[model samples]
Target: MKTLLLLLFLLLLPIKTYSAVIEKIEIIGLKWTKEKFVRRELLFKEGDNFSKEKLKNSIRNLLNTHLFYKITPEVKEKDGKVTVVLKTKERFPIVPIPKFRAKTNRAFKTGIEIRDYNFRGMGNHIFLGLTKWFKNEHSERNFYINSMFYRIIKDRIDVGITLNFFNSYNNVFTKDNKVLGNYDLKSFKANVYMIEYLDLEKIRRLMLSFRPEINKYSNWIESTNQYYLSLGFTVDKTTDMVYYTEGSFYSFYIDFAEPNLSTVFTGSLIGTYSNSLKRGNINTLSFGGSVGTKIGYSGNGFLLDSGIPGYVSDKVKGKRFFNFKIFYRLALINKTVFIKPTIAGGDAFSNIPDNFLISPGFEVEAFWARLVDGIIRFKIFKGIGSGSDVQTSLKLGFRW
Candidate 1:
């Protein structure tokens, strides 16, 4: 029958000409070294067109350039012309030192903390801390101070300053409703940060903050001062989430604050989502949310006069308030070493133009922050609350 139908059309024409010869090859430019590849032009040329998903996306864009430490992509085909090669391995960057530990009987108790991170890479960081607190009931002792500063311009400006005293006694509204006394909370903060890198890993961060606060409630009341200014924005995205597990992250942030004594000016929104799953050792699931609003213009009053007892000092003029929150996080040794547990809740509603009031609460946390290899961290924070103003706290600190 006509030579077996021409042998099935010559066997489907070589599988449709090898799937159309894979149109265009990929892997254009990627670099790091030789002076950031000629000041970031990243070397890769020639009328490019070779496929295999563009050589695995140029080997994930040269290992996301954290200064690379091994990344190789090689492909060569003769007679038809196709050659793409990129091999890089280099790493040496360090700035890590700031460690901490803490305890309290009503205030201050800390051990092992040394801060200094040798800078000069167009980025600088500094920290100095010393603490000890407990003034009565036999443990008699009091001395405190802490500081921090960070500056950078490599990827676009970031400046900061942080100072805290006595660390706010684990801060639950800075102590009042009968909490064993010996209170002191002083804070000064200034921050400006902006970062953009929407490719090769993705990132965007923006922040502007100013905080000045003072609260002293020692023998039980009257010692308050407050001022706050804030603006923030953040968006982060990362991919590659399958087996080796070192990816999958998402974040969102929004904030606005203006408080010189409370008549309301705090709008906030925060969100975070994380995912990771692996059997022989990796697991993570995180989700978080927050919403808050308190809008009023003048009538400044009620900024901590030993609050929480029949709250409503009346100068809240055009009043309005609202809050909402949700949280879930569980990560156990998720790669290096990590353990986080959080369950949160929130409810606060108050209005005057048409009267409304609601207050609800619940929060719990078990924390751990680390990186001792770099020099410090083993942080801790414990919190608990069921409802109707019953709060608790325990915190240990360290950050670098």
Candidate 2:
């Protein structure tokens, strides 16, 4: 009896002494991405206790990067030590976009752009593009250099900057459906922004930005130099795969400009929020609202763009606006393609419940999985109450 008891004690002791410690981590199938970049997204490192939740979170973070085509996780445990292996298949990183359009007596523009999402195996982005506009058989060229993100410290902080040179022409119109005036603008602008991620993924964060511009206007106004600063905070809890399928997002930003320099505004505030849910593969529903107010604003370029199908942004005008919107999308082709429909009602005035705008519209989206910018979209919309019009357009790229 004593000998039998001793053997049972030995087996129980081994079980009691075992601990699920991470002994090693191995990342595979990386050619352009660095191992450190993958490690940064992980919630645990070597010699740490194992957690299934953290492993799942790390996978979520990686998927949100949109840097991989497929990811498979493998785990092995022996004598309570765990070894994890993550094998990944990367997507094509280099993306190019070419645009062309020509319509008589309308504003049509063209551009060519190239972007690199991952620069030098580091998680950085850079873009170079050129745009040209045609007016009365003459072409105006625009030059720009944009850097989307550059990590400078602690992996969570980033900076972005842009330099743009342009010769632009635009027509100003009044509410009476008549042309007010036209202006030619020769301008140079510089923009810089910084972002700090509160989580491993930038789905929630804080943002600060500055834009300084110099404009040389032809006969409409004098040349001027002006700048503004914007600060915003966002809180988001969304699961991203192919696209953000469900969850909630809330954000607000305030803008401040030089006093009496450009009348862009002394200060302005905007806030918005949305919550979404997925109902099987049938559809995803999202609802949200936004409010805006401008201090010392001209209210001339007022726009109400809710991504609702039947309205153009510039047709609405106001000094302050508040609106509510509902959005829906039907999933097809494994959620790679979507049928999006939207409805919104509100006005850019004090009376929110009376005589507001109601817009309803829908669009079809298709994507090619091989290319980064392979999304194509067709949209149609109609509005009731205000800015009512029938509009349809087709576009290529991922802007929507």
Candidate 3:
């Protein structure tokens, strides 16, 4: 009986545990966002093991949303347990934006856009925009509505919808830089897209989209209806979403359209890389190219635009093109203001001038969370081949 009692006592001895368990989680500085939304983005939960890597990734995920201007994490240990604390400063979510641009010997365009980054305290985004172009008595107008919704699931699926209407009286140019004629175009379109997070490390997404559109042209042009389908993929590893200072981004997409029951195909690829230098300076480089071709009786094509600084999109019309750009920015005024000088050039081939184009430009941008964000830019571009001309452009925009 004594031996049996001693064996039972030895078996009942307490075992020691070494892993630190989370005791509590504290979140501070929330003005418009819900606590659950912030907690949903976290990688660690109560009673989970304390992991520094998970905490760092949680902070990065929160910052990528652009919902906070500052985020800090703190850990406290007591009685063999740990407490995690998060401190955040929220950004102003609503913005009323105005934009204006003009080019040498080209029509001036002006527009206004309103965006709500945080709609109804959720992570949804909504935007309404209008644009107008003035060229003598010929004017053009465009209106659009865009919205995005995110599901609160583990995979975090996102859906977006867009509506657009446009009416334009455009002047056409010839190969020798002469005005060919003016035509009136009217169009309306509706688009729906869904993005699925592929449960990959650090933000990889896939998108599927469908669009239906109708267009009418004046002066004995045929009116038509079209349907489009698209597939897209993106890999974003950027450290800072608002002001990208490091990491890389890559995206590729292909689109198919049935215009008047004829099949057309288009595809594009784009990439960007950014790095932060010492003393608060940043450098960024980007390059992109697109190809569009018609099959059989398809009439749709691709056009290059001033989408790239110093290059005019309307100046080139082609079935395929490529472009490259380099930008370096100097930090000034507490890192909130930046002076960026850039150089970009590209050429269009197949149905357009096969000449190389070069453009050099500079930009001034100021970003402040307290007041407003604004930018002023100027660029000068020269074409090196046929149908090329030296052009200058100015642009201004404000958001708050």
What is the per-residue lDDT of model 2 for residues 83-116, given as tens digits with 9 covering 90 to 100? 9999987767778888777687885778888878
lDDT of 1 at 128: 52
- Candidate 1 off by > 4 Å: 1-74, 78-183, 186-255, 258-260, 266-400
Which 10-residue window in model 1 sums to the lowest lDDT? 302-311
Among the numbered candidates, top lDDT falls to 2
Candidate 2, residue 358: Cα displacement in angstroms equals 0.9
Per TM-score, the best of the predicted structures is 2
TM-score of candidate 1 relative to the true fold: 0.25
Candidates ranked by TM-score, best first?
2, 3, 1
Q: Model 2, 268: alpha-carbon shift in Å? A: 1.5
What value does the lDDT take at residue 363 in candidate 1? 29
Error of 1 at 102 (Å): 20
**Global lDDT for candidate 3?**
0.68
lDDT of 1 at 225: 59
- Quote each prediction's TM-score: 0.25, 0.84, 0.77
Error of 1 at 113 (Å): 7.6
> In terms of TM-score, how similar is model 3 to the real structure?
0.77
